[model samples]
Target chain A: MISARRAILVSARTLQRTKPLRFADPKKIRLREPIVPTHKNFDVSPDHPLWAFFRDGNKTETVLRSKDDLSTDSRPWDMPELRLKSFDDLHRLWYLNALERNRISTEAEVAKEIYNGDVSLFTKLDDNHLMTQKRIKQTLLERQVAYERAQLSSPEEYLQLFEDKYINADESAIAEYNEKLVRLQYAIFGIEPDLSEYNLEEDINVKFVEGLSYVAKLKLGRYLASNPGALELPLNGVMEELPFLVRDPEVAVEEVRAMREEGVSRKLDNIEVFAFLRNAIEAVRSEPEELAEEEN
Target chain B: MKSTSFKCTCIISQHSPGHVLACTSCSRICSLIQFHLFQIDSHLKFPNTNEINQNLKHTIPFYLTAEQSFSWLIQSTLSKCHVTSLLLFFSKLQTSLRPISITSTMSFKTAAKRGQFDLDRYVGNLRVKTYKEFAKHSRLPTIPAPIPTLRKDERLIGEAPIVAGDLAYIVSGKHKGKISRVLLYTRDNDTVLLNEVTKNVVIPKQYWAANQTSHVLEYPVPIPRKFVRLAAKEKDEKGNVSYVVAEDLVFKEKYYDDRLKRWVPRRFVKHHENIEIPWPSPMSEPKDDQYSTLTEDVYNKTHELQTVAKSPFPKSVLNELRNPYSKFKKRELTEGQARRLNAPQMPLSVEQKIYLAKKAQTPVKKLEPLSEEAKDLIGSRMAEHLAKIKNPLLLKHLEAVSQKTTPEFQRVLNEIEGKQD
Candidate 1:
């Protein structure tokens, strides 16, 4: 047993000689995993603070490829893909992220959407990113309103209503409730929910029929039947089916007159007759007086 | 009265023709002639009187020619006229040839009395002629009145008025005594220059004449001779007051005795006493400002109060004593000492020393003894090297090398030259 113990001691000595002495305590050895040798390997360890940002293999590859392309022997600290665990190192990483985010045209808007969804996450970012996020939210809201206006048939009406309704609202309230929703839908989702998809000219024929409510269709049909001369055949009938034209008094009167000789029964509502007279008088009044005296 | 007896004696001697009876009338006439001749000689003794006498003799002989013995008189007169004219001419010539008179009223007798007889009639005639000539040619108008003489009390017109000495008073300065006689005139006739009568002296135009009632003593009083003499003697003994003279006072007697073996003067010994002198005071004595407290106390107690206990010697003696002590102390080491201290350790190691010594002793490079051709080549090459090198040391080293192996170098140089050719 003494010989066995001596043999064990000799084996332990050989092991100590064979292996490198662990000068660093186990708790102090923070970076236990060795870095991968591949140029594309930009993976942050799970224990690292920046792991969540570059977790995806594709994202890691992209960041590593960019880092490799920008690598230099003199400036290891400047490498944006390098993930360090310290707060100061993380702060540098966030700064680099902010710098890259600003370089992208759409990053501001994307960052705003991210911030609005998770404000605590945005606040965790450096101050520069927080400021950029606010600026981006403002820009996105403006762009969303512009896009919404672009989709509108009558942007003036919507703009007037929007100004009247939201101008009086608190800035935070408008941004949080009204502008946020609109901006999300328009800018982020690229969707205009309030606008119709129908083309004015081509969809005129089916606008009254297709996707119409039963009550609406019945009302429209009965009105058309009683006032048969209100619509001309073929093209006129398509025109009469237009959503805006059907409600227009001058168009109904003209359609009635054009259809009268075709033996179509039609009776004009008193409101329609009054509208027709008012339109005729407005037309006479709106005409240029002697061609506006030639504006010389 | 005895002439008759003499005549009888003369008759007895008549036979000799010199004894004719002498008549009284003849005696009387002869005597009268002798008397007249003596009177004329006496009168001629006066200057210019001899000329007059000679003229009278000539005229008397001419006047006697009209008497009974006229022929005899004529002969005598003619003979005397020659002598008379000769004498009168000499006298007139002498008078005319005189030197100019210095002043009027100088008489010929006075000139004779002065032993100026040669100039006697000359001077007299000159004075008379000058006075006559001056009187005739003078611009001053003559008056019938006699010439007036200036008296002591007389004053000239327009002359400055002189007050009586007793009437004037002294105005300023001591001895401003009353003005007396006018002393000397400095300005024109109008101003009196100095008044001797006023012992203090008044310059006439510069100082106003003093009134009688004016104070006589306004000047500074004269200082006594004793005070001045004492001050001068003191100044001479001490020299002009100076710090060096004052510093010599301490141990002056001892220094004098040591240097000259004699006692110095008390003034020389006490010269420094007057300088910052501490006078013995009944009250508290003032402290000396020159020296530090220790020095002052030592100096005062030692030199000033010899009776006090613990008396120190003078500074000079103290310095003399301290000098030998300082000399006995160890001499200071100079900067070279530090360098020498480090010199032994300068060589890096034994190996370095052996290497350095061997390197120093070894010949750096060697060359085979050259043939004449090789020497000539090297000589030309060295000349070229020397010509190219402007450094004096390099040139000197090359020259030395050339001197060391001249024959081989010459052979090498010749070879070089042959190759070049």
Candidate 2:
């Protein structure tokens, strides 16, 4: 019913346009099921346009295969398996199932007339076939819901919401991050940086992350998100899916942007260096301890 | 995508407090559910849980990039993207010219992935659920737990000390130093069901069958963490592998496992040279006997793996959903990351060819009717860009962009003019 409505809606709109359907009705009317294959309801002609559908490659002996045999021939993709499939995969599978269903039902009717017996075996295969369609649709619905819930206009827009390397931050933010990172590396190695020029992309982004284990990269991304004025990707939206970047409760952006405007950027002439800031935080952290000791 | 179909009466200041978002639910459902195979509970827009925090707002405003800023041409998120709408719906807010409490949590600064909180309550809920399942599945002559629940202080936090498939050494009791596979673990009570450790249960008369003699059956017994220590295979300095008591098997502080993209509690074994033993990736269970799926294929995660489709859903969708997030929810085959994780095959089959033919024959889906908010956004954005152009003819496009320019456009224009002055 859903497919029919969607087809008709598309067909109605297509009628307005100049291009006609390639193999459908002359007026491009898409029938939900194949009507051209059937003959006055009961008998189907051998050479009908959709003859390939009614007969399963024109096989006859296998039509009466036992209930057990029929059940094994076709089965629905369950939730777990269906969930693994991509949208396009399911879209293809839906068509396959629809085509197979049409064939099986036609065969089932033919088998009843020829053998003068029940052809419920086709129904078994059809049931499983229908189940797969049901699950496929269910899976697609879930994806649509998830996409809507994420509130993404496009996937590109969502990349900004995460702190992924894919998200392109301004050169200023990256360069600023690079300076701090270079300082940290130098601090760790007990060496002094040139203090003048450093290319951010080369100074330890792609190469450094590529060398470090993935765990190290995550920790680094965490560090980037935690530090202010470092790498400011718009940390907006529901990050329920990608829990990679650890977010701070608040960011001191107004101050940082104000500083950026004041020309205290990458070179860090007036800004507090990593070591100095660490010392300041430590000093602030110890003040409460000292006061508590005094009270005691 | 057309954002909203019809002009909501809210445009007329219909609601109280002068600020209410139009029923985005109606518009969203219309587009989201493309199939009518199952009935969608329109009310079930957001998955509400008592422990889960719905408030995803940040404390500070953050600016999105110019490319990302172009999204208001279509849509914004709900609870998840609740904070994301700062820019997307800013035009709408300007038109309404109202301060909404719902948007108050729009703190864009912290991308707080703080998904679930109130851990204690959350844990309690999980335990209660597990207990119910255990009770339901328990058969006749069920063994009663000697100790029921642990005190809040005693209860283990983070990941349980023992999990299924872990080889645990019985430190004390009748089975002292006996190594066994831990089949199950109850976190609230430091109890583990060891495959080797079992208690003989006397068959009750109610459980006995006709002409059955009274006898005992052994069931895997739950051992306290105090009685069990994790055992691991360790190579001596001589380079021969042998089992040893995994010394100092303490959970290292929670770190995000980048491969898994979750804060997994990793256990460090001191005896094994402090090598981290990540939680064993749960083996994928074979599909039900009735599913007609190959047992090996299910175990190998090869079911329908070849039916690879270039996802219409974004790459970020894969990143977010993590290659079908539902599959990973059970941690099934985390180690299969390198096992053809990215399926490369999409040979257009006959069915697919037909699908494409039908798809082409079908008319393009109608664009959603642009909401008043969308017009406001495009107008405001265009105004900002057009303000720099001193051409008189091109300036008319700005006026024609929106029927009524949003207040934000006015502010942007004022800022531009002020800068010029």
Candidate 3:
């Protein structure tokens, strides 16, 4: 029912943007449009585009599986092979996968509650979804590489390659590359490259950590959250999801600017920290003698 | 009565003062009639008059006159014997104006046995409740959602979910009696990865052959810490001493054994008892929630703001790059670094490539490792050069030119010279 309403809302928005269809006879027009039952109602008019959906016939199946019922073949739809020809196609596919992943996770949480905290059903669902997403990303990365390679033969190859190397690489890679690049320039001028002041290995490690696989990144994030002083990543948001790796500082600057527009106006007053502090003080005051004696 | 002086028969008094006798030693002045009455009631033999006088002389309060002492003695004796006088004195004891304080003899008993001062009473009122508990109970009480509570024995086995690196006893399998260490904790998959520490058993036809194998079970139960007892070291015939773990030892702490329906050693508790090993206090629990611990202030401050997305290049990388030789010298360089260094030097440009093609290149000298001081000097000069070049393109060009080794450069020079000849 919710999906039907959403579909209707989307169609309604599209209808609003364009002209209304003119009927030959005014009497033929109906007052109310037929409602689409998105969640459960599979039976629909044969002429409808979704008629193929009812081809399998009515069968009871939940949108999300419970933890115990999770299996490899539990996904609602199989991800198609990646033969993305263009950037737009890749982008669209990425968006679609992200959308599905979000929906599955959200519905899985609700399903967990409905099943009374038994999340075994969602276990296989997440595994399958993550695998599919990984495949999609691998396809997208291939497409991006191919596109960049194709661009190299173009008239602006130098400029394109320059952007590819500096902008496309992650921030830490760019920094390391930049330092090395500078040293190279000095060498070209017959001057020695200065690198002794910097710890190149540490820099590379930080960059390597930044470039860790998504699963590794999540694991690292969890580890850092539990134990903050784990591997020190370059970014302050070590616990957050991967940030855009663009060479253009202006892009990052603009993003920061946009974020600041929606940022909090007031400083957070941590009542809990203060509350803890106050409690500690009161405890000390109440049992100063005993505490002192214990210390002695 | 005055003519015939009644002899004082009071034990406390030696002589009588007229018809109303004042016993100087007794600290009581009483009528001769009262003194005569006391002598008749008290059956205990009295000391001689002289001995009584000596004791009374020391016992009497200085503030009391001989008459008062004689009267006090008569009153004390009467209160003990006469019901009317005793009732009067008891009534006075109830009032605030009573001459004496009646203290109960309860100080001799231990506090635990003392009825009013039981330790349990105060301690019972002193709860271990925290603010969270106070808040939980203070709210409007609602019917809690009922959850199925498993019995101890039923709960003992896989009651508490097993984690990685836990120890377990295989209750049902090809290796039924084997003790194993948990490897992978896949709660979703009813099977866990385990390495058997005990003697090896033949692989069942249905299972794969290996010392370590993933076994499917009805959720393998974790061996409770209480069941794991420290065993004494034993010497084998070969004179090798080894520590053996004793699982049969009764747990010192009494635990309710559901199957037995009685308090028993914790080891006797059901194999499925859902007992969790008490974890040491976590420095901080991993919290994805915004309201976690001392950092809540920072979390709240950023709550409205989107969390900074992770950056591929963090400033820490730059800091590392700034001091590559220090801190992590033992660590291997990342593959990315090796790739970047080996990347075919970016072509300087179409023009530079053409220009290099026309020139007769000079042979470079054999490379030598720089001394520490020389490296420092070179590093300082490079820092100055880096500071001056803001153009990324120029830096790329440098990277391209610096890719070749001395041998590679020498070959290139030889090729150019051969072309010139």
Highest TM-score, which number? 2
10 residues in a row with least lDDT, candidate 1 chain B: B29-38
Q: Model 2 — TM-score against the truth?
A: 0.25
Which lDDT tens digits does candidate 1 get at residues A115-188? 33222222222333444434433433343344445444433454345444443555457445444434433332
lDDT of 2 by residue, B167-241 (tens): 888889899978878888888677888887787777777777567676676767777777888887667899998
User: What DockQ, between 0 and 1, does each candidate earn?
Assistant: 0.00, 0.01, 0.01
Any runs in candidate 1 off by more than 4 Å, and if so which? A1-52, A55-126, A140-296, B1-421
What local distance difference test score does each model get? 0.33, 0.47, 0.37
RMSD value for candidate 2 = 37.8
Instruction: State which docking tier applies to candidate 1.
Output: incorrect
Which candidate gets the maximum lDDT versus the true structure? Answer: 2
lDDT (C-alpha) at residue B307 in model 3: 13
Candidate 3 lDDT over B1-421, as tens digits, reads 1101212222111121112122223323222122111221222222334433333323311122323323433433222223333223324333422221111121111211334422222222242223224435433222221122223333344332343454556555466655556654443223445555333234344654345464422233333333333223347899997544444433346665544333544432234234323211222233342212233322232111111121223345343323566735648678777788886766498888888876747565544545799989999999899889999999998888878578766766666555432
In what order do the candidates fall by DockQ, top score first? 2, 3, 1
Residue B143 alpha-carbon offset, candidate 2, angstroms = 2.8
